[model samples]
Target: MKEYKYTINGTKYEVAVGDIEENIVTVTVNGEEYKVEMEKEAEPEKKKPVLGKPAAAAASTSDEPATNKAAVNKNNAVKAPLPGVITDIKVAVGDEVQVGDTIVVLEAMKMANNLQAEKAGKVTAVCVKIGESVMEDDALVVIE
Candidate 1:
């Protein structure tokens, strides 16, 4: 058996992975039992070589950390307030949203909580999908 730590919102759970050949995994979250499917890992694909000035230019820009800083500065990332399973996602990428708009619905402690936007802006990215568990302070969306 292998131990794994999963966090949703800010809460943490310790889970054990067992019976890989049977494709079954038993997880206890917050004292509740959950049966999960164990999928086989796939091999990584080979990377293809890029040739041309454009590729060189892209590679050069990627080598600089300034590009990363700029990307982070371009959007205001919203974080999860607590560990929970995402019940719904109300907004999509490129969607214009307003302050107080429901961005995601999370189920925690058997209660459904709506996560609203903090400010009015266009949604640039969504980090979590419906039915996915998220940890506290994890990026939920990016607004620009």
Candidate 2:
């Protein structure tokens, strides 16, 4: 699945592309899923080379750390408040946190927003890494 966020005419939309079969595609927008059929199959675009390292590559190769999502308690996961790129992670697995403690820093619209914990607990999962982009409701951490 590929996720993307867009804002048009002051309306924000979170989109996720699921599968593609021939001219039909499965997509989800703002929590609503839909199947869209194309008029015809379009040719694939050629790749353009010779540029600096791509953002995705840089993010993957960065030293920033992340915890294993498979071990996360989904019920206790701390979800993102809005769409943004993760600028920093302030807590790690096994760390103790208090209510209102900044757990992550999210950069949205050029402003860094500190996402704080809602309840006190021990951090059990760090679902996002620095430079990673996330949409509203995406899980960033898990505390229990």
Per TM-score, the best of the predicted structures is: 2
lDDT of 2 by residue, 25-108 (tens): 999999999999978856798844323226446747744434366556678888998999887788888999999999988888
Instruction: Report the Cα lDDT for residue 38, model 1.
Output: 71
Pairs that collide in candidate 1 are 8-83, 8-134, 8-135, 9-82, 9-83, 9-134, 9-135, 9-136, 10-83, 10-136
Q: What are the lDDT figures for the candidates, one per model? A: 0.72, 0.82
List runs of model 2 lying over 4 Å from the truth.
1-67
Question: With candidate 2 superimposed using the best TM-score fit, by how many Å does residue 138's alpha carbon deviate from the native?
Answer: 0.5
lDDT of 1 by residue, 1-144 (tens): 577788989989887655544777776655567788878777798844322335334534443433343455434878888999777778877899999999988878878889999999988777766555788887778888
Residue ranges of candidate 1 with Cα displaced over 4 Å: 1-75
Model 2 Cα shift for residue 19 (angstroms) = 46
* Model 1 error, position 138 (Å): 0.4
Model 1: residue 108 alpha-carbon error in angstroms: 0.9
